[model samples]
Target: MQKKSSIFTATHGVMTTEVGVISGELELRTTCNDAGILTLAITYVGAEEWYTLPGEDYRLHDPRDHEVVHRMLTNVLERT
Candidate 1:
């Protein structure tokens, strides 16, 4: 079994789970405006994985996911 340990920044408004076997981790971009201020909400979608109870680190058996995630995120960010 594999899991994630960190929230890797996919882009300005998107984020992805890092150090996990499961791939295709994408987050929707949401913005909130209040008092003329804006806040971005990165909502992650797709599969779900759990980490150790006492720790926040996760394991990824398939290291390929990490590379893919980075590539995908970069492409999306560049487009947007």
Candidate 2:
């Protein structure tokens, strides 16, 4: 598996039109197989633990997967 990671300052406002801002660091990890299938994992930057959506692993195979991941991350970040 190939793996990579990145950290970025993220604000909850990016996911919404509201004026309030909630800021935090986001860590994104992406892994791929020899067949080029991708999997993604995320956590708060600097945290030791990672999380995936309920009933779902990090593996991503379609656009719906991407959408769900985005929504999951948004919900988590908004609450943090």
Candidate 3:
């Protein structure tokens, strides 16, 4: 469930199970499949801006990387 690829134009390729702290501006995009939906969030790490998401499983490639990227984006709306 982990893939290290630069499949994006501006991101290091959205991680499906990544996690990290926010410290800047970020762009996010979430989509849904046949069974469920997936959320993609990117933090600028400079503007401290990120997508509004919470309470879900996530993953990160590097152990030092704590940003949620390639993890399962579930129960996001529940944070409200």
Total clashing pairs for each candidate: 0, 0, 28
Off by over 4 Å in 1: 1-25, 46-80
> How displaced is residue 77 in candidate 3, in Å?
11
Off by over 4 Å in 2: 13-23, 53-80
Q: Model 3 over residues 1-80: C-alpha lDDT tens digits?
A: 22221112332233323454432224444433333334344544344544544546333334333224333232231122
lDDT of 2 at 54: 31
Better of 2 and 3 by TM-score: 2
Error of 1 at 32 (Å): 2.3
For candidate 2, write residues 10-44 as lDDT tens digits: 66423322323324776666566655466656666
> Mind giving the per-residue lDDT tens digits that candidate 1 earns over 33-80?
222222222333543543212222333344545544444434654343
Worst 10 residues of 2 by lDDT: 13-22
In candidate 3, position 17 carries an lDDT of: 31
Q: How high a TM-score does candidate 2 get? A: 0.51
Per TM-score, the best of the predicted structures is 2
lDDT of each: 0.35, 0.54, 0.35
Better of 1 and 2 by lDDT: 2
List all candidate RMSDs to the true structure: 15.1, 8.7, 12.7
Shift in Å, residue 62, candidate 2 = 14
